[model samples]
Target: PGPGAYGLPTTIGYEKHDNRKQRMPQYSFGIRTNVSGKDAGPGPGAYQVDKLTRYGKGGGLEYTMAPLTKFKDKGFGPGPGAHDVHLKPMFKGTEAPAYSMAARHNFNFKKCGPGPSAYMYDINNVKQAAPKYSMGIQTKVLGKNNSPGPAAYGAGDLNLRLNRAPEYS
Candidate 1:
């Protein structure tokens, strides 16, 4: 009785009951004639960018200003001008070639294994472990009715912002 249950005697678990009655698929949905009424045109791997031509090797610096042949008659000098003069000692010869940890990536140094030990919380030495002060037993003395007075334990009274009576506008 289980193919499409066409045989009816199903009471073993009554079709595994989730409030059971669902058999409706004897097949009746065929009328879709390949559904395409209109909008799907661009298909040869469609990813269009019409005229965005950025094909490389073409940015700033084409620079033709050699018209300043030695400033073309020097009419612009207000101060330091021989091409701003540094006459050569900007960085000459301290012979710099020494950083070669065997020329770098040779990779062989990791053996330190046993780590985590230095934490010692209190073996008694910060001024002999300090903490002894003692001055706190006053229970409750402001204008002395000695507290526990108002709404003592379930505590709900003083909502004080100057005891709230001020909306007088």
Candidate 2:
């Protein structure tokens, strides 16, 4: 979930049952290295020139964004569309490494069915999602602020004008 939208094709998967747990390794310890040389295409690789490598154990986590009752009251089943939180923390990197995985229940209702469609059918006819938990390693790169320091400064820093971007409203 970084910047720059080149509009790449993405595919999702759904399930028909609830009790969901992501597919991240319950446990894993490994190493990964990405070398950005004089040129490695564009976008993320545009600022290359170093071999960022980091390794460690890490996992994943997914859960309802809201409480069970709140979600149920909103006509949402414990399906993949019930508004969930996804996080993949890696243990190493230059400014931030990355990880990815997913888990969802269908209440017998999962739909990679296009984009965010599961968000539609919330008949309150299904049960709530059971509690789920996960642990993982922390990546150094992801933790870095790219500011050459521990602090993270965004567009708001350096007195950047807010109206400069489309979200200024």
Candidate 3:
């Protein structure tokens, strides 16, 4: 909820080697970690963390995972920054927090089809952002660890979404 006590995040990207193919991006991974002594919250020994992965090659694939606790009821929830607010749902609630994870993969979102000849940002040959047309089959699951809400729930999302590169100009 509140701004992760103190957060540390990292990201990494990768692609196949190709001297003649400069704009061929493959995949990317990211992770986040937070460590706060509670700030007078429920998770003194527990913190929040997030993760995501994106694939630009072969249609499109996306994966996301994040925490889903700190909320007591449907009327109120915690903020993204540090705060002393606490929530205790009177029903259908537990005292523990858990993370939600989802994954999506497909071949209908290659907007660029093959992308332009130029690549956006990259490290060690991996493009930072994928070109247009990055849609596919998606799936999501929340409260997998029996957090405060339902024990575990998930969905199979089938939607075509577009992916585009940012234009500084």
Candidate 4:
């Protein structure tokens, strides 16, 4: 004669079954709320029961798309220059020691003087006259594929113009 079974019969009985038959539970519970809302309070820190309208801080999502444009030159100096200068062996030395490390290698420049002056042999040695070399002028342009142009100063080529030449000749 329990509380609910007060008027129950003496031979009353109930069936019993194992509740932990499955590995995972059949049901679960979770809390949902808008934490980034206007009516959010500073007390219990925004729980699932709080009902509020959310809003972003600043700029919203943009709907327009930007297109790519060709690179434009805005200034006035040399546009793109040539890649690298190529150097070819112009003169070969006669004496081995003259071109060797031990002996003083000299690169003489005989200026075209009047009638080969008697005492005009200015021994322009390597240490005395450090010879400066020059390369053929060529222009190259970087193409769409980022490659140098075939022709000098042509389309897609880098231009290298000489304003002046060496004073010594």
Candidate 5:
């Protein structure tokens, strides 16, 4: 009952049971070495590294960590000195009424930039005698027909048919 009340309480309970069996609580796969001297410069090579080791006790430990979120660019159609060739008739859920037509010659459409191919011309009769070329149409709207003029008269109230028809040999 002298040298630490009994040999330092059995040498501190056998050194805490040998440090709890050498810090038990492990799922280990290891390779660890460290020796630095003689101007250590990769002189004792064994390089091929990828190592992870963990050991736990008593309670807990958990971790988890994720990270690209919208992009659109659908373009191409209008090249070759495009002047006019725009026709849009998209009415799928109703509400498309306002027609007009009378283009027996002069027809125009413009909305340039962005290409793949679209802006065609050449309407039969040898390109309709080539007067800047004509033969392009796009229609929608099923109402309005004020009848009155019809002697080469080209007015508007809405009634232009033909979506795209110009490309003859």
Candidate 6:
């Protein structure tokens, strides 16, 4: 098949003018290469490096109820340089100990329903009430020898009969 049958150019036919112009072709190069390596210069600081370190001198990010008192500071019980042998630690305040306080204080226990104590029955003094009638296996004579009736026979008293043909020797 010719190029006309497939929609492609077999030869340049539209450039038939004799006054065609020519231009110089210029080339530029951009060679790219990736060389992976660690940075020789000092890099950025690690996460949270500027923050307070453990057991640092300056007051750090930690929160405290009160500043630490030095041994020479005053105020532990009017003693020499605030150094007094107290029974309780500083965390325990002047309030009474928990054991000395009244338990379940101001907490009203709601009466949900009638408990066993509210019932008429007394657990410690329980008494068995007598039944209205007696209950037991009756031993009265049903019939002779417990045969249900006098006409009913036991297995030892049964007599079964059988008829047989005369036997040949």
lDDT per residue as tens, model 2, 1-169: 5776565433323333223434332333665444755455566656534533354322444466876663345344465665535554454433444444865323423343565543667656456766766698756655444536544445455336544545454
Assess each prediction's global lDDT (C-alpha) against the native.
0.54, 0.48, 0.50, 0.51, 0.49, 0.54
Best by TM-score: 6
How well is each residue in 23-129 modelled by candidate 3, as lDDT tens digits? 54554476533465545467544533223225323434545587655757844766566463456444563333445585533345556466676556658556555
Q: Write the per-residue lDDT of candidate 5 for residues 4-76, one digit (tens) a residue.
A: 5642223233344544344445344876445656455665446433332354332345554632333544346
Candidate 1 weakest lDDT stretch, 10 residues? 106-115
Ranking by TM-score: 6, 1, 3, 5, 4, 2
Least lDDT summed over 10 consecutive residues: which range in candidate 3?
48-57
Model 6: runs farther than 4 Å from truth? Answer: 1-45, 55-105, 108-125, 132-169
Clashing pairs in 4: 140-157, 140-158, 141-156, 141-157, 141-158
**What lDDT tens digits, residue by residue, belong to model 6 across residues 56-160?**
644456578997976855454576655555755756644444564555454334555766677685665556555556587757766655566665766562234
Q: Is candidate 5 or candidate 6 better by TM-score?
A: 6
Q: After best superposition, candidate 1 residue 21: deviation in angstroms?
A: 72
Name the lDDT of candidate 1: 0.54
- Clash-forming residue pairs, model 3: 1-79, 2-79, 2-80, 2-81, 3-80, 3-81, 109-133, 109-135, 111-133
Model 3 score (lDDT): 0.50
Q: Could you give me the TM-score of model 2 versus the true structure?
A: 0.10
lDDT of 3 at 79: 54
Per-candidate count of clashing residue pairs (backbone under 3 Å): 0, 15, 9, 5, 9, 0
For model 4, how does the per-residue alpha-carbon lDDT over 1-169 read when each residue is reduced to its tens digit?
Answer: 5578554333322223234333343343866666877667566654544343365233445454678577867674455663323454445655443344576635655544545456555566635876677797766876777865567454433334644555693
TM-score, candidate 4, is: 0.10
Better of 4 and 6 by TM-score: 6
